[model samples]
Target: MIVGLLRSLSAKVPSAVPRIALTMKPQVIFVLGGPGAGKGTQCTKIVEHYGYTHLSAGDLLRYERKRPDSEFGQLIDSYIKEGRIVPVEITINLLRKAMEKTMTENENKFRFLIDGFPRNLDNFEGWTRDMDGKADVKFVLFFDCSNEVCIDRCLERGKSSGRTDDNRESLNKRLIETFLQCTRPIIEQYERQGKVRTIDASHSVDEVFNNVKKILDKEG
Candidate 1:
């Protein structure tokens, strides 16, 4: 009689469980790679194809450094030269400001293809407040290219950047330092979540953009 009662209670409790449905907030794609990994090129494709608002943190930082009296301008310049991510609070503030601008200007119709902002896990943690705990990463596109290819491209684009560190030694050091200190675990974290998408970037610019377009197309 006790066994019969126990079985009946278990059956009732199973049906009484709450029926929770999963809902995803808007998708945000972050493009990450070493310098000269064609992130800007791919960002252009995403913006053109899917109407994503492109926020290039490097460009923002570069512009800020041009102002002679800008606070943190010199520090930002030195950090970029070393291929290191800026302090978490500074980057988070910049990102938040950009996001706010995009949302207001677009009336919340904009999707973000944030380029080169979050460079470490701490940045990721800081971003949680923005999402209100309902944040879901659509994907992390890692532009996988060789250091040799990156260095070559950086040198060829000298007219635009006019940067002394665009040369072979500094470029190589940047890439090596980025790999050693930044990318490995971040890649692994996204891989564990099944949100990492990689593209072979040793191709022509058009070819790489084509690959990027294919990935962003899925969300549209």
Candidate 2:
């Protein structure tokens, strides 16, 4: 069912885009976690130590929403304000463009820490078709943190973060609808493939990254 959806969506990509996607083979590490699960924090550490490009799906969406003439800006803003996941097609297009741009500019091997992506089954399917066999997901990094802890962290960060979705109202929806309902199944799928590396994100920043560093060092 999901594969069929991917196949259907693949035809929607522009003719020239697939050629670019096919040529830019990158080592992709998907970073998955709930809101305030420290995905961004850990991704920064991974980038500094491993030289991987950190592409946060949330950041990409936020930037696109603020872009001067983006066609998806209003639509993205509505979904984000409601704490609903954006459509997979839009998200994957932004991700693929970012990956292609980075890969084209750099002569070295491309390694990407794609944070908070493949948020649901549709996202996973879209990514598979969109990349056109160029990149393989090396593994998924799942940051395990309790909802109570996550909410507290988000609230603290919200005081200064200025992100609309960081408040209590949207956090509730994101925690339940986005994380539990959508993301958990995606993690399970990767777990079945033996491609998931779980990290305890309930700890201090240093402690969490210590665990992260170990995994990256061993994996890379």
Candidate 3:
């Protein structure tokens, strides 16, 4: 298993870089949000500025779904469409494999920002097992945006993305159910642990990213 590892002491660290260290296992920063909450924008900035690998769980599942020959292709696809999480074992294996590949491929380069993962209590449990029960969770970034804004963004993205699931009805379902069934408690879990940071995602793209930058800076 190729486990991707990222170290902070790489030469010529960026000015905004945090003072994290190399780890046998990569540090995970989870970015949580409702659909279309500008998680992607913040993730992009995180990668560009702070040297983190952004892993979108939705994208990963979608890619898995596209491989029709795979056994769980349709099963995984169905779960995502209903704004439901895939089975814990399946998800954990996929993420672990991906992370391992990343570690080996990047020579353990950057911290990993996992977007849309640990969508439920079970997902969290599975993740703990996958991480050998002692995973390092840096923190959670919650992109707080109104449902209306999220719907608008999903609709906008759907027009060009060839993703049928991004349509109005499906997106509405996703937004409502995602918040209710998945994100809310996870947010609270992090909050209880004092690891949740809420970001106002109602602003313009650049403005939202600026807020994210400030948070990362403070944490670093």
Best by TM-score: 2
lDDT of 1 by residue, 37-131 (tens): 89998888778777877878777777766779766667677777776666555555565566665565555544777787467777676666444
Clashes per candidate (backbone, < 3 Å): 0, 0, 4
Tens-digit lDDT string for candidate 3 (1-220): 0011112212222233222223556778899888899888789888999888888888888888788685567676777677666666665556666666677677655478889877878777667755653347889998999989998998899989888788888877777776656768878987999999899999999999888889999983
lDDT of 3 at 171: 78
Find the 10 residues in a row with the least total lDDT in model 2. 13-22
Question: Which pairs clash in model 2?
Answer: none
lDDT scores in order: 0.69, 0.87, 0.75
TM-scores for candidates 1 onward, in order:
0.79, 0.91, 0.84
* Clashing pairs in model 3, backbone N/Cα/C closer than 3 A: 2-100, 4-103, 5-108, 6-108
For model 1, state the Cα shift of residue 149 in Å.
0.7
Quick one: best lDDT, which candidate?
Answer: 2
Work out how many backbone clashes candidate 2 has: 0
Provide the lDDT at 84 for model 2. Answer: 92
Q: Arrange candidates by TM-score, highest first: which order? A: 2, 3, 1
Q: Between which residue pairs do clashes occur in model 1?
A: none
